[model samples]
Structure formats: structure tokens, C-alpha cells
Target: MRTVPKSYYKHFSNSEQIDFQKQSSLITLPQPRAHPFVPKDHPFFVRTDLTAHEMGPPKTVRTISQEAFDEVVKENMEDLGMEPTEALQDAIQTLSLQGVDLSGIVKCVPGESSLKDNPLIQSLERLKQLDLNSKDKFSDEDLNEMMGLFDKLIELCGGNEGSVNAAVATKNGGVELVCSICYKMRCGSKRVLDSCLKTMALLVHDVQSTETFRTGGGPKLLVNILIDGNEDPEILNSGFAVVAASATGNEVVKESYMELKIDELILEILSRQRNDSIQSLYDAIRVLLTPDDDQVVASQVYGYARRFAKIGIARALVHSLHAGLSSPSLISASIALKAVAVNDEICKSVAENGGIDALLRCIDDSGLQGNKTVARICCSLLSKLAGSDSNKSAIIENGGMDKLIVVSARFSDDASVLQEVMSIITVLSLRSPENAARAMEAGSGDLAIQAMLKFPNAQQLQRSSCFMIRNLVARNPENSFCSVMVSRNLSDRQRRTTKSARMQPLMH
Candidate 1:
């Protein structure tokens, strides 16, 4: 105030001058572009100046979201004022580019189709133009598009019959070709294959149950279109996969094995003996093992096992038994052996064809991964065949008791395998205590005690082992060493050793 100091006035004037200049200036900034990848909204929005020295042209490789794809597809259908099929196809192509997820559209059930009723599917069918074998014949583009459409229909198919015809309609036959190809590939797809499998089981069932198919001409209709009459193993093998998965646990599918014709198919499929054939043979055995409706199927099972025992088929089974020594086809090989073991006729064929020796050979092989399983089954067969004194004597004479005792030590830690083996021994002991005595002499108590200690929790195996222990002690009080050996097995859990880069680690 005192007419502020002149120096103060000079500082204040300088600050006021700066504020005046800021208020007078106008700011200009660049505008934002609509495209996230591009910088500006113009056609060449990426470039700040259109006439600036150019580099390469702008690149856009944006992958849209699934929601965006469905919207685009729906909008295209709506806009297809005159040409709906072309519009729908265009939308499908466009959406395919956008990466829509299509995992579950094959059928509502095994053999059924839900395409006719779904709104999206209805829209797609409105765009349908079935011209098989033509340029339009289910073009790869259409196939890709139509396959997603299958995700909406996983219910109707039991697997083989019904609306499979509608899924790939074709006038030129190319569509049908691609259609079957799609199904073949789909057989491996997890989402809709359950439906596909159901349909296949129904197909096998329909064939065996129908007098027309088994006795008349039903196989002709099915095998021609389905089994391929020896052509296109993809079609044949795929059908077999469905049959395998379906018939594995489902009884309705198993009865289909009764027909003498399924045997022919099984033999034909096995004739190849390739991995695919191995897979099919496994499936055919499954179909036989779990037959649902027909009691007569057992006779067919015996017949097939016998036929195989007499020729290349029996050799194949033995080879499988040998392989099972490595990484046996557990379920399939089990059924194969069971096919021979369960039926009297098959057992006769096996013995007549020297199967016991084959089993013994498998037993003798050293360093087998699943040999214990094979041994258990072999022992079971021996127990069954030993209905007479001669049978028991033959088993002991072949060193059966000794061989089983040695093999038992290898899988003592694997409770399930141990249980199986001990179950076999229990049967032998019950049928002939003298054989049990021989088994104890062959060191059965030692193997069983170790397994019991290792797998004390396996009730079934424990029960069987308890019985075997009594049998062993009864054979000789000197075998108290077996109880000691089993007691030693109980406390030790297999330890995971330190892993080095060079060593292959053992895993549980």
C-alpha cells in the first residue's frame, strides 16, 4: 500500500504479463480415430497427413469377438431381402473369419437332429441350397459354417439312424461325401460324440434285433452305407468307435453282437491288424462281453474265440497278451481273454489250440509293465479249467503256482492288481487245498503278505489275502516267514526320489 514498492510492482507486472499471454493463446490437438488400431477416423486415419511421405499402406487384422460375429450373422440374414441363401452363407463365412466357437452342434441326442427347430438353424436352412457334387456341393466354406450349426443338435441321435440325412443334404453326392467325412472327424469330438455314439449303438442293435437284418437283408442296407463294404475305413472305423464306446458299458448295444454277421464284421475288421483294426477288434470284443438282450450271444462269443483260437485270430490274441505285458489293452484284452475263459466251448478251443502255453509264455516274459494283470487272468482261466484233478495237476506241472508267486512280487504295490491276483489264488485254494499248499511252497504267502501290507486298505484284496494267509499257515507253520514279509510291506510307502535332469522319474 504505501504505493507498493517499485521493485514489488515490477515482479507483479511480470506475473500478470505471463497470465495475459496464456489467456490469449488458442490450443489445437489431433482428433481421435474410430478404429482402435488406426489413429484417426479418415480412410487413411493412421497417417497424420494424407500427403506426407508415405510408407507402406495401412494394415488391419482385427479378430472380432463371438458376440460381434453372431450379431453380424443375424444382421446379414435380416438384410437378405432377395437372396437369403447367399446372404446367410456370406454371414457364415464372415462369422467364421471372426472365430465363433462351435463345439456342440452335431445332434440333440445320438441319432437325432435339432437343426430343423433351432432359430439360428432355421435361419441357416432358409439359406440351404442342396446341390451335391456341384461347385456348391458342401464347399469347405459351407462345411465349416454348417459344422458349427451342429453344436445346437446333440440330443436326437442315438448315433446311427434318424436325421443324419438332414445334417448334410446333397444332390450332387459331394455333400454326402463331405457329410460322412464330417461325421468321421466328429466321432473324435468330445462335445457331440456322446450323441454320435448313442446313435451307433442303436444301429448295431437295430441290425441284430431285426430278423430282417440278421436273417433277411438288413445288414446289406446298413453295411453298404455304414460299414463301407470294405471301402473307406474312416467310415467303418468311425462306426466301430461309436460301437466301442457305446457297447462298452451300455447293454442295449452289446446284444447286437449276437448276430453271426457281427462276427464276420469283427473278423473282417481284425484281418487288417493295424492300429485301427486293433481298435476295432477291441470294440468288437467289448460288444461281445457286455451283450444286453440276447442270451444266445454267449454262443457267438464262444464261436468267435474258437475261430480265432484256431487261426490267425488266436495268435493275435496271444500277441495282444504279450503286448499287454508292456501296456496291455486292459479292457479290450480282458474281454478277449474273458471270451476264451468264460465259455466252455472257448476254453476247449483255447486248450486245444495251446493257449495255456501261450499264457505261460506271457508269464515268463521279464520286465513287463502290466504282466501282473495278464497273470491274474491266466490264473483265473486255470482255476476255471481245473474243474477236475487232471486240470489242477496240469497247472502245477506247468509251474503255474511258482510263476504266479514270482509275478505277484512285481505288482505287490499296485493294490488293484494285487487284489486281482490274490482273488485268483483264493479260488485255487478253495478248489484244491493241495494246490494251495504247492502255491505256499512256491512262496505265495511271501507275495500275498507283501501285497497285504502295501495295500491294507483294499478290503476285497485284504479279505482274500487273509484267507490266503490262513491257507499258507495251514500248509506249514514254517511259513510264518510269509506273515513277517507281509508285515514288512505294510509300513513302506514308495518314496519319490530326487529327480535329476538325466533320470526318468517314476510317477504314481
Candidate 2:
């Protein structure tokens, strides 16, 4: 007999119970299917037996206010009997180790005023507090103290954050203050004036500050400095540096300087044999002569260059390139020469004034001394001078091709110098098959191949080398065979090292 559960009978009515009994006797149920097996470590497997209490409590985060932190520092100083600075440092270290953000925290000792909080501001305030009645009334000690303060300000303004410091200083009237100081001490001592000029140079780096300086008679003041301190190299260097720094990219400022006859003044300085201020003097001239993208400014700059050339600046530039000058001075002079050589006549004049021989000697000397920068600049100047037909003949006649190849080999590791050298070769071999032959004979083809192989990543060097090879092989068939052979060797070397197919066209 089959028995029914009492709970099943409770769900049926009296009349439905009879029908369910008949149906239950005929009904048949299917078997249950088996479940798939899953490993306990599988991500989808859940532990149904675990409870929330077994997972432990959540982590509690604690935060402290600035006032509370200050109280802790006070306790460290009072209870532990530590120095105020020591106490502050210890509190900062302990909190920082615990992953606390300590930004916006003042990092100075306690009880110091906010003025003393920043050294730059403190220096500015000290300078402002000075009583500049007259230069005569100030003692030597007073002047020395003022110079020291200025030096401190210079140091502050010459850091990695110098631009920001300059902005802050300008906002606080630093430019006007320095100009006032300069006017008061213009006649006092050369050392003070030098420092003041240098300080002003660093301050007027931005356009706003430069405009302030320009509007506040900075150009006339610097011109006075140049005129009064012409015999003093330190004063002249600082003065010219200010001029260069102030006039960069500011056409209005440049016009103001030109109006004050700055070009004529610089020519007068360059006429002297003093090598002390050569860098700053050349830098100032380069900045003034350099034109912006505006056509009007460029035209004005062209006229300025012509005026400079007529005033004997070419001879002065050539005169400064003597062998006795240092590498830095030589580099500056070469750059200045490149800038002023704006025309064929100017270029020819440079060559006529012993420019070729002087440049070759510089390349040789600087290459031997391992001063690659001087060598590079000399090669670039040679390229610029090679624009003229007579200059090209002069450079070749003076063995410029051989000198360039020698520089190429010496500075094979330097992509910049090699680029300059190859460019000069390209310029010299523009139309003359004779110069092309001279270049190949001087081992320029081999140097070019080596440069292409050594600096595969230097796109400009690669382009320059290809141009050089093209020029070498374009007119002179004899050199073409040599270049093809060099290219084959480069191909063999390239096959061994890298599988890049880009060098194939360049090689051939």
C-alpha cells in the first residue's frame, strides 16, 4: 500500500482529494540528473558555510587636523626638550612615514615671521628698506652690504624655478627697485654695478618684466653703463648680457635699443681688442640683428646688418678669430659672423679678411683639443661663407675640404659636428666637379658612409650624408664608383647587424 503524507492532504479540498488519489496512482516521476563537478579553488565556487563574523572587522582610518599636528609638535618641543627645528623635523618625518600628506606645511622653525618665511622676499624687503640718499653719503661698508644683498637676490632668482621667482619678484616691483638702485649706484663702484646689471638681466626674462624694464628707461640706463664702464670688462660683460637677455623676441624693445644707437655702441666695443667681453658683446649683436617672422621686422633687421657691415663690424669679427682666443670666444665670434654674413658681398668680405684661414685653423685647433662645439660652429660658419663663388674657391684653395674631412673623422661620434661638416661638403660641391673630386680624394666619401652607419637614428645626418654622396657622385664618375663601393660595404654591414630595409635606397 502507498501512504500519502499528511501535509499533502492539507493542500487538497475534499472533492479534489478523490481526484488526486486516482491521478497519483497513474502518475510516474523521472529520475534526477547528476550535477557537474567543480573544484573548490575555482572562482565561481562559493563557500556557503562562511559567515560575515569570520571575515573580521573593517579597517579604521584616522585623520588629524593641522592644529592638532601643531599641538603634537609643541609637545615634542616642550616635553621632550628638543630644539624647535628638531621637533618640527621629527614630527614631519614621523607623519610622513605613516603615509600622511604633508604638503602645504611650513618647513621653517617656529616663531619666524612670514617675511622671513621666504628668502627671496626677505632679500627684496631688505633692498627696499635701504636709504639711497646719495652715493657719496654711503660708506664702503654700506655699499658692500648692499652688494651682498643684491648677490643674495641673484642667487634666489637663478634657480630651477627662476622663471617663477622672476614673476613673483616682478609682481613685487623688483624691476623698478633694481633700476632705482642702479641709478643711485651708477657712479659708486664697478663691482656693485656689475652685480646690479647681472641681477637685472636675470629678472627681465619674461615679456611683462621686459616691457616694464623698457618703459622704465632700462635701455638708456644700460647704454649709460656701457658708455661709462667701457674700459671695465666686468661691467661691459654684465651690461651687454642684460641687453641680449632683454631684447630677445621683443621687437618693440629692439626698436627702442636701436633708437638709442645700440648697434653703433656695440660696434665701438667690438673695435677694441679686449677678449674679456667678447661673448656678451657678440651675443648682444646677434640678438639685435636677429629678426622675427614678421616681414617688417626682418626688413628692418636687414638694414641693421648692412649698417653694421658698413661700420667695420666684419673686420672686427674677423679680428676676434685669432688663434689665441679660447674655445668659447671662438664659438661666439663664429656665430656672430654667420649672423652678419647676410649677403654675398659681406660673405666675400669675410673671406677677403682672412676668414677662411682663420676658420680652418679654429677647426684644426679645436678638434685637436677635443672642443667639438668650437669645431662645429667653425664648420657651420664655413658653410655660411661658402655661399659666395669666390668664397667657395678660397675655401677649397685653402684646403677647406681636407679640414672638414679631418673634423668629420675626429668627431665621428658627434652627429651635430658631422652634420655641419657634411653640409659644408654639400655646399662646396654644389656645381663644381673639381671640388667633388677634391672631397672624395680627402676621404669624405668614406667618412660619410661611416657617419651614416654610426648614426642610423639621426635623420638629419642621414639626409645630409645622402646629399653629400649625391653631390660627390653627381658630376664626378670617378667618385661615383668609389661611393657605390662604399655603399656596398655599408649594405653588407647593415645586413649583419639589423634587418631594416630602409637603408637600401639610401645606400644605393
- On lDDT, the leading prediction is 2
Task: Give a tens-digit lDDT track for model 1, residues 99-139.
Answer: 22222222231113233544434523533442232342344
Backbone clash numbers for all candidates listed: 39, 0
**lDDT per model, in order?**
0.45, 0.73
Q: Candidate 2's residue-wise lDDT over 1-508, tens digit each?
A: 1222233332335655555444433422222223233222221112223233532333222233445466656765675565677667766764443234444233456665332567777777777777444443356876788799889878878888777677667766789988888887778888887898889998898766788999999999889878888888888888988999888867778888889988777878887746544478888888878885252524367777777888889778888787534644777888888888899999999988898889888898877888888888888998988878789899888878888888777888999999999888888887788888898889887887788788878888877877777777766767657555555766565333322212322221
TM-score of each: 0.49, 0.72
Residue pairs that clash (backbone atoms under 3 angstroms), model 2: none
TM-score of 1: 0.49
